[model samples]
Target: MAGGAIAVAAVGVGWLLWPSPSGRTLPPARARVYTEFSACLLSDSSGVSGKAAAPVWAGMQEASATTAGKVSFLAVAGPESESNARLYLNALVARRCDLILAAGTAEVAAVRARAPALGSTTFVVVGTGSSAGNLTVLPVAPPAGVSAAIRDVVVAASERTSPH
Candidate 1:
């Protein structure tokens, strides 16, 4: 948890399902409920080899259990590339993930660029700063360590994705 910086990208579905008035008689809003959600973690080369990887991965598992969500990790084989990061993120979107955690600067940029187009998915950028459409950039300091930061991001993403 003491190595390179980490970022996150997530897809949030709760807001989309929440009934907003389009000036039509939408059906009565029922309480939103989520038995489970799917989360995707995108990591670049630095993240895979960094000391923080194991702890961050473990934290994702723990977060999954705590939030009742299924988590998947994708470690891109090559070094960081914005285009590649976008490709990976698009792949996760195709899988219909509710939340995405992108763990690097490149990944964060990719998520930021693509987030607006993916309406239902909530993108959480861990180490970056910005609030673009559905993308939530968490500028969390790493003083508590990368794993803890990742844990918090995942937990928040899961909560946001959940139906309330």
Candidate 2:
């Protein structure tokens, strides 16, 4: 039994040391050259100055720092209504943002409603909600997760939307 145990241990260690079949070593970790992707953040009544939207804004800021792509944030400074939401969505599309980060239910609905007209821009909703084509809803809570989710969603969308 002891001899068998030794053999198993040796096999495990051997496997760990074994080189890959191709014999090509992995390159050192380096900063990635991400294709340029623009994003816009639309907040509700809180906008960027209020406590409610601060976490969301900070999260996006961090996400922007980690990527090579040019990411931006835009907070709607006025009260949120369907009409206002439409205006902001239209403006974001006009600004040529590939992704839109809608910060509340109102923003999500506005984006969802307008998604048909703007075919290419992907709307990533950062709060609890449902989504469809060109719209991805991520359930957000506690503020910190919002940033991480935003980064992940943006990265994934960038990969999908980028041409080969």
Candidate 3:
């Protein structure tokens, strides 16, 4: 099965990257190279506040390491107004993030309004919402759905779906 192959590959990679006597893991014979993709998260002014936001960001961070991509976050500096969130979303878009993750309610609303125009960028709402061309929502029911969506995006990035 594919899972068995992946498990073997992971163990092989671990062996190749085993720690040295100096405590630093050694590089593999040929390092796997990935594209310069970036996944950015948009949250409220106080950073991650809600329960789902932290886990969502953690998933993104873990994916970033696998894909050699960049993971960054921007918290709306003021109130959680849709307008304020729009400004921060604009900043992330300008940075050419391959995927923009909307965490807070205001951020998700702003993303919904703006995602139509930014059709080239994929926007993923970490909670429940509707889907557009480049925008999709992940339900917050079972925690695994969120993790699976995050994993899906990592595979997407690895497949060169990034708008980089």
Give the number of the best model, judged by TM-score: 3
Q: Pull out the clashing pairs in model 3.
A: none
Q: Which prediction has the highest lDDT against the true structure?
A: 3
Tell me which of candidates 1 and 3 scores higher on TM-score.
3
Q: How far is candidate 1 from the true structure (C-alpha RMSD, Å)?
A: 20.3
> Per-residue alpha-carbon lDDT of model 3 for 50-77, expressed as tens digits?
5657767777867876677777889888
Candidate 3, overall lDDT? 0.80
lDDT of 2: 0.72
Summing lDDT over every window of 10 consecutive residues in candidate 3, give the lowest-scoring window.
Answer: 155-164
Q: Write down the TM-score of every candidate.
A: 0.64, 0.67, 0.72
- Clash pairs, model 2 backbone: none
lDDT of each: 0.71, 0.72, 0.80
- Candidate 3 — which residues are off by over 4 angstroms? 1-34, 142-144, 162-164
lDDT of 1 by residue, 5-57 (tens): 22211123555456767766668887533356787777776554554345566
